[model samples]
Target: MCSTLPTEVQNAPQIDQDSGDTIGVLDCLRLNVYVPNKASSQNPLPVMVWIYGGGFFEGAAGWYDGSYLVKHDVVVVTINYRVGPYGFMCLDIPEVPAFGGDANSITVFGQSAGAGSIDLHLYSPYERLFHKAIVQSGSAKVEGMFINPDYSAAINIAQQLGFNTTDSNEAISFLSTIDSHLVIAASSSLGYWFRPCKEQVFDNVANFVEQDSQNQYSPARIRNTPLFVGTTSDEEYTYDMNEFAGNPFLDKIKTHYSLSDADLTRISNTIRHFYIGDEEISSDLLRELNDFKQDFHFQHPIDRAIVKYIEQGANVYQYIFAYSSDDSPVYHSAELKYLLSPKFDPLDESNKKDLLMSKCATTMWTNFAKYGNPTPESTEEVPVTLDRATVDKRSYLYVDDENGNLLPLTSLPRKYQNWGQDRDWNRGSGVGPDDGVRIDFDNRTVVGIRIDSENG
Candidate 1:
């Protein structure tokens, strides 16, 4: 009954488990609060806020349920924020007030695009908003989400609605004056993406993004609270092998980092060589293709954020979710089946082991919310103690490789460069957690972005 931003209400590829109605609204900024029965005014429970991930274009609060998590004796808050253009316009607008909660014990967590947003908070001055953050398979830079206002989307989208102008201010003005629905329709028609653009920060700028995490990575500016990072063994564990032939995401990356033409070609060759070596890109190289997609889309960006987190002196707890129902490969966002449970889980049929994993993930997450550490003490469900990943040794907890047994935290080989077989997720290896999370194809093709301000 409230208002959401001017985005299509449905999530991209759809959250199959979310049986809620999908309708776009404008004024419904809501906080779906789930408080444990034990919580009272006198007794404030540790708060964990859920941020849905839909590539900054899709997602809704109505699709998620926090009741399963509240059973763990924590206050769960599912938030709704302005997305697409409304969310990231960053044009000197009044700041929207977030839900008021126990600030000291707040832990923000999300997956994919949601995880990317959580990672962004670490760079802002408002790092104090949450005492801790759990980033799942994403960071601010994931999927080339952040950029300067280099694209002509304002003019192009306006032109779609019968307004043609090259002036940025004028185009924006025309866009602002038109019916919001008209703008949305036009944007949808031309595949315009209104993403978070890196801004030039100055004195008295209200809610402006100053620098990118890559160019302006300042460890001193971030709040080094206890951080938990989760990654599925493969981003998109299973896919049509031929879909990724010669489709390197470097085109998007070329624009994201503003690479030159010469540099682009050189980097592309190097990357393509690494992924497929001298072999031509085709259906035959499914494993290499998956690796390339996984690295470019998820792990590399997350790895960048991890390096930044470590540099900031944050107590970082990294996890690789490898549990599969039949001991097969687990796909991207696979842990969500365990983390959200019952509802919000696409896999309707859950085995006893799945339920156990649900307990393990929920307990671990809620434990981190209550106390910075995930495994302060071993429980029946989670018998293994998790160790923090450090600068010298990048050790992280491997979650439930065995269907029933919680695997102890183990040290991964110093770098991913050391691994020869990156695609085999189920392979038992001393280096890495078999495989890290994979990337999605929809993220690249569905969401269209300008490669450069001039040509693309």
Candidate 2:
């Protein structure tokens, strides 16, 4: 057994909501392990590791309490990885995936940046690290801004703090001496973020990424790895919708696909016309904006990755979180609250559906970890059998209380890739009402009984 790291507050930075003084302890790499009561030396339980999402610049392990999943008899591990400059700071230090991925039995799962981490791992030299993966709301096929190759942000941050250093050594040295929290705080103040960078191949140093992962995504490269990939119906609804108004997919389209200037203009104009017509914008801009963001960031990339996964003969379980409220629609990271602990557990009779949905989430996740399939065989808890994506069609488990109409992938981005407007929901995207399409029945698509549970 490995000895544990020191107990310290999360290595957080100054963000919009969270202040650095509160939980921003720096360079703390630790793991919180919650083992089941039944887990013994003789009877070892399966393990589930949690990687929190904070756009790669923020987040800590303490945010997610794994005690809820431990009730189901699996060992849960939540780890603290350095964030901001510290997360990607060049040092002779290290860490995967013994639990991140071990035999074919292990399943690596995460949400947003955490999910994006899985994508990085898949594209890196470590693609074979996990046999199966559960990517909730992120993939490597992101915009250029997220993945930078230069150390300009680090230098910019150093200059912003106090030491107006131009040399890389001087910048890193100055930034290193300050409080980890301050470096992060300074980064925020400067509006500069040091994200994952593609490294130049050095002889001895361990490299996380050598080539741009966004450009490296391909079925031939990823090989056959079972995937549990999904996205919420309205992936942008939970955020300030205004953020997406002017920010369109055209920029991502330019970088994602190397197109000529003439071709790029034609595609951009077509996208603008299809999604948001006229420069004044439409009244349904927020609604349409949500759809547009979903398609660009989450929905489109996920489909592209899924197409590759299926092409490589990987068993892929796809889904869309359709549950939402009047206040917040089913958006990015919507399905996470139900999967992990530390969520608002409403005991009132009016919220029975929420409780049942939570149960289904935990069971399906644990099921996926134990068995390669999310629903190897359905039980009272998980009533429906989730089919995997095949070469012919894309099968998905729509996690919603109402509506089962499929959002045909072909309906999106006609000029973007000419992937064909496949409006047919025959095999991969087919789901009759009998296969647990709606929630009016006894939570048919999921599995769980309100077994009392909570976590610190």
Candidate 3:
């Protein structure tokens, strides 16, 4: 069975000169390619590049093993770019002349910081190499701008470790002189959450926040490629370390915002207004903290980008991961198991059902990569009224409850609107300390209910 599995590796060529001195030019230019052993002869296998995300601080090409996608008849490419301040920091260096070359029609995909990089590549002045972009669990709103203090701290730390960042001519040159680990360590101390600073306008791609509606750098003109955006059920669960409950970072945030004891009670409110399209923070007290984190970081930001893409008349699709397990902590990257293996869970029939849902997800994703649409009915997942140019009927894939069940994306809002008619429905009845907000169920109302009495 192991010998029957098929995969091959290749290197993609870079058509540009290395101006920065941080990493070797050969290392900076090389990209790893995972090819299918049994590619369709009539139509060369569609490509799906994976970009691993570690908050822009940690991750490498080795982190993602693309054998699964390759076995499914897709070419997977993972490339290494300069990371942290070295990869992203702008030093106002003179522009190098563009290497003359034709572009390839490819689809770029990534999660977290990788997702932001996809967005950046789409808008880069250098001609893009991809025809579609799949941004998973990352949005430009938070990633579009870097905090000035964080940037300064990163540079200062790099210098302390003896890496240069000041002189444009010597910066990339000196970077190549130092060990990779040292530069990474110095950048890590300043924090892994740096974004491109909006105040210092560099180029259109780096200046994501500065690009306005009227500006040519908007997402509408950023890329003429198909788009796929998604997020995990609980994106931040992995980051919650109980040991750091009283960490200095929390104290610093509280002081910066002047947060009082009462403010913690309404922390959701601040997060909502700041990130969730000004949606009202749920008034329910139970589980407010979890819901707030979900809204600001995952749900709200992803939703905003999806809507924006739809309004622009670009091809798009929206999805929510509703499958989870009672035994598993509802945390980030939990869905990876479902995608990587058929037997991700086996203890119960419910786990078996989630396996089916995982199949539906992979099917939709591969279908979109091959056809430029998730399904035949929709090229983009946009709102009804927001779509004005031509009626591009949008549909969503809802892997609901158990099994590979799917429903129209619009059914969520319809279910919400009609919940009052159901006699068993109660909006605020089960409200409790951990129940979070009591609300009518739509598609977004995902819960991993415990069925076993022993677990209960």
- Which residue pairs in candidate 3 have backbone atoms (N, alpha carbon, C) closer than 3 angstroms, thus clashing? 21-172, 21-173, 21-176, 146-195, 146-196, 146-197, 286-436, 316-380
Give a tens-digit lDDT track for model 2, residues 210-272: 666545545665566778888777776634654645535456456565555655555555555
Q: TM-score of every model?
A: 0.78, 0.77, 0.62
Candidate 2 residue 372 Cα shift, in angstroms, is: 0.9
- C-alpha displacement of 449 in model 2, angstroms? 49
Task: Please estimate how well model 2 matches the true structure, expressed as its whole-model Cα lDDT.
Answer: 0.59
User: lDDT tens string, model 1, 249-276?
Assistant: 4654464444456545554554555556
Candidate 1 Cα errors over 4 Å, as ranges: 1-23, 90-101, 150-152, 163-179, 200-203, 221-223, 247-284, 341-344, 347-350, 401-403, 413-456
Model 3 regions lying over 4 Å from their true place? 1-30, 40-42, 95-105, 143-155, 162-175, 190-194, 197-224, 238-286, 325-330, 340-358, 377-395, 401-404, 411-456
Compute the lDDT of residue 181 as modeled in candidate 3.
53
Order of candidates by TM-score, top first?
1, 2, 3
What's the ranking of the predictions by lDDT, best on top?
Answer: 1, 2, 3
Higher-scoring candidate on lDDT, 1 or 3: 1
Off by over 4 Å in 2: 1-9, 13-23, 89-104, 126-129, 144-146, 217-221, 238-265, 276-280, 325-328, 342-350, 403-456
lDDT of each: 0.63, 0.59, 0.46
